[model samples]
Target: MPQPQPNLTRRGLFGNGLWAAVVAGITGLSAYLFGRTKQAKTVWQIDPDKCVACGNCATYCVLELSAVKCVQVYAMCGYCDLCTGYLDPDPKKLDTGAENELCPTGAIERVFVEDPYFEYNIKEELCIACGKCVKGCEAFGNGSLFLQVRHDRCLRCNECSIAAACPSQAFRRVPADDPYLLKGAKESKPAGESKGIA
Candidate 1:
């Protein structure tokens, strides 16, 4: 004769249901937290004060063309006739020709603002984020030229590849409301007063 089957008690069935509910609750909470982590993300910026002009910003960005671009703090700029940022060291001549220009892409635009003073601007469309201009400007002239992340072109990846590769650890997060970390967004010292960045 076959043995009788065990009774299906109501209490046992309730206990099973309770255990299933606990597991589901935990899974749902995990999913919610994952979403929250993504939602609470911050925007990226370059801390101009810490940048070493390492050339990593040009090569390491995930974007086909890096989001990094050079910015000029006109307040700090001397408006020199011979802008070291625009022209090579011992340029053949002080002219706009590619031969005389230091920028690999010829992105620096020199404009005559007045006698003995010229205005320099970056051609964003042509910039390659190489930091050559930044290095030149910082080394021999007023430290007015600096690299900044162009948010318009930035993908805003969860982890920026450029930041990881930066030797100086210059990249940082800023509030979305005020994302830019421009060198001279505020007033700066007179040209050549200090070599230190900031």
Candidate 2:
């Protein structure tokens, strides 16, 4: 003997259709959100041209040690033996002694490259991002030294404290793929040339 089929109700059909619609809407929304999550994000970066070395990076960073550090533009560096950036203004002797160093933490290391040129390397571990070296380099020498945010150390906060405190408004949201704003990289002339001459 064959069994009879259950009755199909309009209410049940409408309820099922509504449930299907809700599921489809939820799925579509989830897909959209997932795709958005994969989209490229912008990270905070300093535009070297706009930066005024205001010393805010040291004071305003949320991290105990600021993510910002001094970087040398080697192409622009004059490589002088008596580097104003490396030595204090009034050093008793042009020596590599800690007392004579401009960096409070002695982060900048002067290495003999050749005859009169010396290569300055920054020890990031010791850097305080105080901008003292950067200021000195920009004012007296080739302006090779500049401050940049170390992405590895940066928290990438939604609202960067250092950025908020920057007086020059140098901080900007740059694409994460190319976040750094390097100095001397774009210039056609050597960085040692005086302004307007280049």
Candidate 3:
């Protein structure tokens, strides 16, 4: 007659439980690790109000070409025919002529927006981040044009290199959900609204 083996043992139960626990733990850990790795990196951003358009953006960036670029606030623009930002700093003529334009790369495009108002558009492809257009606009225009870093070009380092070199200290971190702190149509006038930067 053959001897029957024991069906269940304390050792067998303990060993099976241990393996189950380990596998469950591993699965949980893998899910957590995968989620963390899939998340995007948060990075420093520019506050348009604090930016002085000092032309530092052109030289301070790590890349050969700066990630900063001038952006137009169409809603705030006067669209003047004789835009100081578009024309030469001291040009005898203030038209679309290349010689008279303030932008070194002719990145600013002017469109007629009825009498006494002209719509200015930025040609970002031509922009070199020199900030001449921003400077001119801030000084003479509505202070609408400003610079911001393109997230695609930004490395999102733990400590931003451009922030260190920025004279205005305009750089700040924002939540990943609300990446850009752009101005709304209605500007807030509350005294407490001045603290946060985009």
Clashes of each: 0, 0, 2
Taking all chains together, each candidate's TM-score versus the true structure is 0.77, 0.75, 0.69
Worst 10 residues of 2 by lDDT: 189-198
Per-residue lDDT for 83 in model 2? 90
Q: Per-residue lDDT of 152-196 in model 2, one digit per residue for the tens?
A: 999999888988888887887766776677986646523321111
Global lDDT of each model? 0.83, 0.85, 0.75
lDDT of 3 by residue, 1-198 (tens): 977568668888899999999999999999989887633545566777778777877887887777777877777776778787888977877678899999988889988778877889988778878888888888888877778777767666666667777788777775454455454432542222223332
Indicate whether candidate 1 or candidate 3 has the larger TM-score: 1
The full ranking of all candidates by lDDT, starting with the best, is: 2, 1, 3
lDDT of 2: 0.85
At residue 31, what lDDT does model 2 achieve? 96
Better candidate number, 1 or 3, judged by lDDT: 1
